[model samples]
Target: MKKLIIVFGIIALTLVSCKNGDENNADKKTAVRKKVPVRKEPKNVSYTLESAKEWLKKNKSKQNLKISLAVNRTDKENFAKMDSVIIPTDLSGDIVFYLPFPLQVDFLQNVDKIILFSYPTQAFAVYENGILIRTGPTNMGKAKDPTPTGLFFTNWKAEETTSTFNDEWELKWNFNIENKKGVGFHQYELPGYPASHSCMRLQEKDAKFLYEWADQWVLADDENVKFKGTPVVVFGSYDFDAPKPWLQLIKNPKALAIPESEIKEIIMPYLSTILKEQEKRKKT
Candidate 1:
């Protein structure tokens, strides 16, 4: 009996030692540590002030872009369109048009004096010897500040401009006017009829040759013709004699001679003031 009790006591002692070790292991598991994550750094972009300025300068430029158009001012709806009729200088010498209030084509009839139509309306007129040659729709400034309605003379022209005006400045044939800094005629790209600040606008090609036309007569170096205080009559009404002036024949493919009754009349060798200048040049 003694031996059996001793054995039971040993076994109980062994069980207690195992239970203590198990509790110690449970505590260690509950106190386990955690790992931390690593972070990455960001990089910065750099540029020079001069380089930035150069980029902006290239992007924001206030330049006057050039454009060409074909227009007919007689029809308010057809002011600046290129549909059917185009009077090219090479074809008939009337392809280009100078839009002074309401003109659509820049024409070179090779005539003596040129006539502008559509004084203040979209539709203007062009005639040669009492015959209606062409018409189109155009836009002019407000009537309060309208383009004059009269027989005006071609006086000036410019192919390119360096001005900052909100207009197509580099123009062809800036015609004679009472005002120069404020008024004249040239080629313009109008958004619609009556789309000018104060000058006459026309198509680029028309304006190009028109400038040459006016320069032939008025520019001092080539000043061969003169019409001081030239009559710019905008009757707005078409008359046989008034509409078909003799000067318009310069465009005739067959070129009918200028009869005395029409132009270069009676004064035999009747030199205009410009004639004296020509004679002096010949003697030189």
Candidate 2:
């Protein structure tokens, strides 16, 4: 009888151990089945005026765009300057027209914004994700004082500032690109050719628009910026021997239209560097 009792006790102990083991295994399985939360990034909602035009053409709607205020008189005049006239309405309820050539740029995915000043074309373009958002005629540095080509960044900006070369010359919406050189983009006279003293001369409206739209570098000290500003690529060269290219626009406006392939070629060289800088900025 004692032997029987012993056997029954052992069986009971074995059963309890197996039950605890099963419970532990079930707990681990429940832990493994738990779902992990995922983080999502914000969607890119910004659209270019060109995209909006095509959308309206196909899916016609009474969707009135919330146009902002006119950048300046020159910006207003630029509407009459280009090929297609798709006017934008401003914040003050003013409708301003601008003509921009269709540019299908698809490669600048790493960039948020880029300013391209082409000396050969005598024009400046503002791009977002490779899409041409805005472009306008520019009077870059003359043959005597040609604007330096290569990659640059927006330094500091001033709403109203005097020219470092001549205090008598008042510049509006001045955004400096080079620190040592007193070269920048600002509202100045455009004589239909390369005229500025190494500056990118733009219309008053373009200057104001860029001033408000562009991101400026934080001044680290008197001479340097804490972080880099927006990228500006000044490429190509003007043939001082020949007449200004835009003069042909009188005969055919499309004459001045830059080929998409050419623009792509200009940006391709600096893209890798720009992307690297952008990544570094994001970390900081």
Candidate 3:
């Protein structure tokens, strides 16, 4: 009977030891979990036009000024002359963050180069290997002369070219996509709206950036294009009747947000065509 009691006591001690070990392990796991830091989302703050200017004044820097001007769809010269400007309060000090385009596009991973112009947001984004390299504001065609939405390749380019519509108006960093229609993107005035005459208007710096980055079509003859240049997708439509989309940011920070899925949807129809062109370019 004494032997049986000793065995029972030993078993009880073993079970208690096992229980203590489990409790200690659970405590260790809880402590590890506590040590792990949680990520916090950025606060989206709204600002009035006056408050925006004040904020710009407080956070004065060349980059900040440039970003502010881009957000307002104007250049430094134009922004300086303006009485008030619309500013995104949640500007993370990066122009890329200020714009609505996604940072990475998985669908565009195979694509070497492509430019996207969003008419609704009045912004342009450049993607290389599915990553957003550059983005800025643009003033597309007016309501009466809406910029045609479709896929086009970069064609002829000139440092300084005379506008076909107006002899007096000189277009700088001019890149013509549609020779017949006289449609192209160039350095021009951005009145914070769609004021261009059926062409995409950009800031001087943005125009120059694209001029150097984008490739021009290789010509077989004067009229025929043997090899196409970089692909440009111009999509969506602006609401001329409604207030400017950027202004809506004052109420809703995500008012102009363009989802990655929507961007994928926009590029889906042209994926085959884009791939075919890419393959042909590789061979050439």
Candidate 4:
């Protein structure tokens, strides 16, 4: 009987020890969860047409005069109805947009000449050795036939060219980027939207300037063209269904300017290639 009693006592003690250990483990787990920090997202800023107009009017003199350029491109007749469109914010919480607002041009410098086009902003900028010499608005390919994104060298140019798709369409100051598909930049209509047929449509003056400024691909005596011309980087996407992003400038003028760090990130991918092309150009 005494032996039986002692065995029961040992089993009971073992059970009690295991229960205490389990409780200690649970407490540790809870403590660890409490110590973990929670990540908080940025606060969303909202806007309305009346609010944007009011903001624009109040700070007219304090900001850059061209800050309103993006919104100005929008159809004023129907702009007020687009008040619900949200202004985008970047990873750093700064307003992210592209308009003719002076581009923060400190990122790229190696190339002799470069053309950077942003779809979101519908804007193109020309740079020489890192300085932003000129910027203008553009109407890119429509949603059905979007302009291709990535690095491309200028292929050839013409003072005037007939559209490959429709001979009736005439393109003035046509600078071809993709010759095979009839894709190029030329002076065309801009209804403040992406309405092109897979080509970039620039203002007449801008198209003329680029035609005269950018070098065309070199051709050998046999007439085979080499990939030797100015580098053009067409990046970013445009949301056609949404109102123009610059309309948000009425809410925050600074939103039209992207942070330079973001610009650096965009150009970093192409820096090595740009350097190689710069070297090749120098030799030629």
Candidate 5:
């Protein structure tokens, strides 16, 4: 009887030891499963004075570097003060990346050509078949003489024309949108802010490019337009009291990221009218 009782005790001890070992193994497996690598999110790079200098040095040899720098600076005067200028990190990239305009707009796919002048951003973008083709800086109306905002068609163009506001001021590559208001876009001085006499100002290169690109209205009579030319949408209000909008880019890289939805919204109101005119042009 004593031997049988001893054997039972030993068996019970072995079973408990095996159970403890199994529990330890399970704990080890749990720890192994927890040692996984995690993915990290990308951080946005901020612009700095040093980076701007480096960028300038790198692109100094570029042909359009001066114009690119001027546009980034928001004016020729600001560009002159390059030491203090804060520019986008991707300054060396395509101009589209820095400008506040979508690369592609779905709604504009059917439209042949359109031009947009953003008052607040002080920029102009040209879209051909919903794809952004070109963009550049613009110095628009002064606070006292603000550029009129609305839909207008290109009326007439001249390689060089005198400003109606001031005959002495010779405007180059001029394209008139509003004959009554004498409002047009042409090559003029960009003081780095809105200093125009209620007219849109562009760099000489941009002015010449647009001169050749935009079409003039087909006039049936002296005052009557038979077929309208390219559509021009001038929208938004500038805050003269506020500092330059591009300055905010120093803090946020996406400060000027104009949302695709916003572009769609802006165009929706005039989409029908633009399409009707486009169809009329096609027929002619």
Candidate 6:
């Protein structure tokens, strides 16, 4: 009986040892296999103008632009070629894309109003966020008599305007809609800044269209008279003739969203013309 019990215990010990060895070997095999691979980032992504909505979804801030303003400057072509050499290189300055007359830009999310400015022109182009959908060209002042460039707040303007000094037919430069302070933008004949009595003009159709563009929907509160929110954008270059204190703030401003090189490139082409004009003065 004692021999039989001892043999049974020996058999159980042998089986347990063999089972443990088999489990250990399986664990080692699984641990030696390769790990899953990681994916890489995409190189570039292309987008279209039609994707404006999709653009806002991805790029919510001004810092993140989905599309760039395609500027083809023909006006300054004889003056300089800045488009090729200026951008994509100097990433730190305000880049002014040269646009033809009536250039259109995308109004991003929450952008209800667009303030437009043209060099030597007195009138400002104002467009509603969504309703108008296009920029309505307005008048500046008159021929030789131009709108002064500088920091300003547009609360209201005056009335009685003409598109042409020769033509009798004229509409409200400030739309004659309401709250006109006797000096506002409206449709007057376009020949030059000397065409008006200090009031900026626009195409009657453009002025009428813009007056109702974002009316009531926009905050008419004036800004940058002494504060900022007034995005004073000038499309043309100025002579070192130097601007008023307010105008100085706009051109040589300290606050900027782009690179210094870009700022240099932007004005460099235009200023070269001024510099040339000045050099001639020195020679004289």
| Model 4 agreement with the true structure over 56-160: per-residue lDDT tens digits | 445444222232323334332222333332322322222123344233344454456888888887878887755566667777888888888877788656686
Best by TM-score: 3
Which digits, one per residue and each the tens of the lDDT, describe model 1 over residues 1-284? 00001111122111000000111122222221222223221132111122222333343321101101222232212322323322212221222222222121112111222334343233334433222244333344443455555334443333444234423244343443433223555555544445554455554444444455433223323323333322222334222224221113234322212222322221112223322333333353
Ranking of all candidate structures by their TM-score, best first: 3, 5, 4, 2, 1, 6
All candidates' TM-scores?
0.37, 0.62, 0.80, 0.65, 0.77, 0.32
Q: Candidate 5 residues 187-281, lDDT tens each?
A: 87776778887778888888899889998888776546788888998989999999887778777767877776787777777877776777788
Q: Considering summed lDDT, which 10 consecutive residues are worst modelled in model 6?
A: 13-22
Error of 3 at 200 (Å): 0.7
Candidate 6 per-residue C-alpha lDDT over 33-113 given as tens digits, one digit per residue, 9 for 90 to 100: 222223222232222122333433544444233112221111122113221211121222222211122222222112234
Instruction: For model 3, name the residue pairs that clash.
Output: none
RMSD of candidates 1 onward, in order? 45.1, 25.9, 25.3, 26.1, 30.3, 34.0
Number of the predicted model whose lDDT against the real structure is largest: 3
Candidate 2 off by > 4 Å: 1-102, 219-225, 250-253
Q: Which stretches of candidate 3 lie over 4 Å from their true place?
A: 1-46, 51-60, 90-92
Candidate 6 stretches with Cα past 4 Å from truth are: 1-110, 120-132, 142-144, 151-153, 157-183, 192-194, 214-284
| Cα lDDT listed for each candidate | 0.31, 0.57, 0.72, 0.58, 0.67, 0.30
Which RMSD does model 5 reach against the true structure?
A: 30.3
Candidate 3 lDDT over residue span 1-284, tens digit each: 00011111122111000000111122221111112123223365454574444555687777767777777777766676667777656655567767788877766666788999999999999988777888999999898888889888887677876543455677788776665565778888777889887888999989999999998877676445678888999999999999778877777767788888898888887866776677778787
State the weakest 10-residue window (summed lDDT) of model 2: 13-22
Backbone clashes, candidate 3: 0
Model 5 poorest ten-residue lDDT run: 13-22
Candidate 2, residues 1-284, lDDT tens digits: the string is 00011111122111000000111122221111222223222232121233323433554222232121111112333333433322232222212112223344555544678898878877778877665666666778887888899888886676876553555677788777775565688887655567778888887878899998887776555544457778999988999899545444444534646676676677777766666566557677
